[model samples]
Each structure stands twice: as structure tokens, then as C-alpha cells.
Target: METRHLTYPDTPDAYPSVMVLGFFDGVHKGHQAVISHAKRVAAEHNLPVTVVTFDPHPKQVLSNKPDAVRYITPLSRKLKRIEALGVERCLVLTFTKELAGLSPQQFVDDYLIGAGAVHVTAGFDYSYGKFGEGTMETLPYHARDQFTTSIVTEQTRRGEKVSSTRIRKLLAEGQVDEAHELLGAPYVICGEVIHGDARGRTIGFPTANVLMDASYVMPRLGVYATRVKLQDGRTFYAMTNVGRRPTFYETGAVSVESHLFDFSEDLYGQVIEIEWIQFIRNERAFDGLDALVAQLKQDEVSARSILS
Candidate 1:
């Protein structure tokens, strides 16, 4: 899919497009339904399916506590998911204070109309423009008959709405398996393996320390069953820990460390992806290195049983 980064008064070459609009942090199931609706409309109108997403998340720009904002799938991963959904193009608007000041009519004219969007689709609750004054109910009033609009109703699973917020909550609670069901895939973290203190090796469980994007939401601090994929496409069943080293240090920075089963290779500086499968146990301080090793052995057995 083609990607275009735009700011106000800058638009891509005009082409007939059926656009799906959302922040789409995780591109979770509800967001997928909106995109799917756009695709259907695009097919009917013989236009390309396009997605309109914002970067730096609007909240990061508008919130009083911007640093508190986290993402389920940061821009890079979100775009990948959009492309995998058969979107032909993705137009990412860089959120700024200036753009945030656009009036409802101005946003409709610049982003939807100016971009040649013949039809637009979004979730029922999606809002736009200064102070979020534009709603799906108000979109047509802003469109002025220039384009069509579709508002996908809230998608539900197990009698609850499927949403990015819900998925993030699940991740924060270490409910990865449930999050996966809502996401239509396992929750994944992409990062590069970095050098650590080499403590895992001394404990008989050599680990690849991962430095993940801080913008992405982290699962609850725990040991988890995971699948690790290397840059070269090799995948391995693994056990992963997301926590500070309480056993070795009284206070330390949180880390993501994965011990791949039957794997022995130098992964320093290598990019890798980890898929969270299940929460094995909460992170805790062990009595000593031997106790840590014994617990890790139990974790490996549990992970293997679950993966099997």
C-alpha cells in the first residue's frame, strides 16, 4: 500500500477514494469492521480503499498529560495492519496544534473533500475537528452533499464493545489471550535485542533483552508464554519476562527478556518480534539465583505445555 504523510493545506493527488477514518491504534476488530465497510463501499463505487489515520495520536497533542498516552499498535505496526486489510493507500496526518484548531467544516473540506474521498466510513463514535464537535451524525452536515458517509455501529464480542481501550486494559491486566481474540491476532511487540547485564546466562536461561518502542502499551509485568520471530523469519516458542529484576536488584528498570527454546545464537542488536500468548505468572523476587533458575525451568515446562 502507498503511504502519504500530510499536513494542513497539503493533500495527495486527487483520486476517487472510499476512506475509512480512525486513529486505529490497534486496528482492533471494531476498527476492522469500519474498514471492511469502507472496502465494500469502495468495491461498489469502483474506487480505491483508503485509510485516514493520524500520527502522534491526537491525544498526545491535545492532552494535558501527553506522555501518559500509549498505543496498542504504534504507527508503523498500525500501517502494516491497514495494508494487510487490503487498503490501497494510507494517508497519515501529522497531528499538530494548528491542525487541531480546524473547524468541523474545515476538516471535512480539507481532509475528506480535498483528498477526493467520494465516500467515508468510520465508527459510530468517531469525532473530528476542534473540540471534537464533528460526529458521525454531523458529518453529512459538514460534507454538504459532496460525498457519502457510513457509520459502522459499535462492534461487540461477548456482549461488550470491541475497542482499543478494552484491548489495552486487557493487556495491562495480562489477559493476552482475551486481547488476541479482540485483536483478531496475538498481541505483538517489536523491538531490537540489546545487551543486558548477562544475568540470565548465569542463571542457565540465556535471554535476549529487547528494547521495545515506548509508545506501545506493555503487558502487565509477568512471565509469559510467547512466540519470538527473528528478522530472518525464524520463529521459536519462548518464555518471556516483562519486569524489573527484583531477585538480583532491589530496584531496576523494567525489561523484556525472552529465552527461546532450544536456541543458541547471538541476537545482540537484531530486530525481533514477540507474540504474547499467555501470562504464565507474576514477576517476583526469588530467594537466590538457584531459585530463579528452578522457577524458570517450571515456566519453560508450563509454556511448552500451553504451546503444545
Candidate 2:
């Protein structure tokens, strides 16, 4: 897939490709549906499928706490998901202060049209430009005879709108099972494995310690059934904990540590991805090392059962 960091200065040579625009934070089912429609439309028109997304999400810029609302999928992961949908090109625009101030019509003329969009696809609630002034209401006037717009309806699963916000709430509350259903896949956290105290190793179950990206929302404090992917691309069934080491009296610093079932290898510094499948138990303070080890063994059993 072609990745372009586009701006008004450099416009596309082509003038009629299908475009899908959104924050696409998780590229969740709803976002995917819009992209799917755009891809199909693009295919029919024999045009390249392009997705326009912005970095440093608008919420981060406009909200009170720029740091508090942790995103589900960061830019790198978002791009990867978009590419997986077979999008021909991805335009990742830097969401600068000036860019955010553009009027609705200016955004359409200078960005959408300049980017060569002959057709556009967006979610029912998608909006653009300064103060979110651009809506489905404004597309026709600006594009004139050159553009066609399709608003993909909301996607639902189990009677709820499949949305990034809902998924984030589910993860925050540790509702892994429900979250997975909305996400249309397991909820995953990917990061680099780092050296910990090796306390789990001393106990019997060796674990790969992962340092999660601070900008991403984490699942609730609990043990979860998970699948871990190594940097070398090996995947393993694993039991993961997303919590402070309460059993060891550690607090404040939350961690993600996983014990790969039936496997062992040196993993320090390697990037690992763990998908949370089911919440097994809440984090607790064990009486001692032996007690902690015993509980972990039980966690392993529960995780294995769920995964199997």
C-alpha cells in the first residue's frame, strides 16, 4: 500500500479516486464498513482506493486533557489495519493547529478536491475542518459536479453500535468478551518486551514483560487469556496480566506480563503483541510468593481452557 504524508502544497496527479475519511482510530467495524464501501466504489470506477486520516487525533488537540483520552489504535497500528483492508493508498495528514482551523468549504476544496477525490465515503457522523463545521450537509455544494458522497450507516453488533468509544469503554471496564464482539476480533496490546524482576521465573512460570504504549487504552486490571505474537512472527497461546503486581505489593506502575504456554525463549527487547480474549480474574495481593505462584498456575489453567 502507498503511504503519503500529504498537504495542500502537494496535490495528487489523479483527480477522481474514491476517498474515505475518518479518524479511524481503531479501524473498527464501523470504520471498516466505510472503507469497504469506498473500496468497492473505487473498484467499480477503476480508481485507486484512498483513505484520508489525521494524526495527533483532533480530540487530542481540542479536548481538555490531551493526554487522558488514550486511543485504541495509534497511528502505526491504524495504518497497518487500513493497509490490511487492501486500500491502495493512505494519506496521513499532520493535524496541525492551522489545519484544524480551516473552514468546511476550504477543507473540501483544498484537501479533499486537491487530493483528487472524485467520490467520498464517510460514517454517518463523520465531520471535518474547524469546529467540525463540515458535515454530510456541505459536501455537494463544495464538490459541485466533481464529487459524489456516500455516508455509510452505523455498524452494529449484538444490538449496539460498533464504535471505538464503546470498545474503549469495554476495555476500561475489563469487559473483554463483550469488547471482542464489538471489535470483531480480540482486543490486543502490542509493545516491546522488557526485563522485569524475573519474579515469575523464580516462581516457575517465566513471563515476558511488556511495556505498553502510554497513549493506548489498556484493559482493566486483571488476568486474561491471550495470544502473543513475537517480533520474529511466532504466535503463542499465553496468559497475560494487565495490572500492577499487587501480589508483590507493587503499586501505581501497571504492567503487561505474559507466560507463553508450552513455550520459552529469550524475549527481552523483542516486540510482542498480546490479544486479550477473556478476563480470568482481578488482580489481588497474594499472601506470599508461593501463593502468587499457585494463583498463576490456576490462571494458566483457566486461560488454557478458554483458549482451547
What are the per-model numbers of colliding residue pairs? Answer: 0, 0
Alpha-carbon TM-score of each model against the true structure = 0.98, 0.96
Cα lDDT of candidate 1 equals 0.92
Q: How many clashing pairs in candidate 2?
A: 0
lDDT of 2 by residue, 21-114 (tens): 8999878888888998998899898998888898887778777888886888888988888999899888888887778888888888777887
Top candidate (lDDT): 1
Worst 10 residues of 2 by lDDT: 7-16
All candidates' lDDT scores? 0.92, 0.85
Compared with the true structure, model 2 gives a TM-score of 0.96
lDDT of 1 by residue, 1-308 (tens): 99999987676677689988989989989998998888888889889998989999887888899999989898989999999999999999999998889999999888889889899889999999999999999999998998989899989999999998899999999999999999999999999999999988877899999999888899999999999999999999999999998988889888999999999999999999999999999999989777888999999999999888
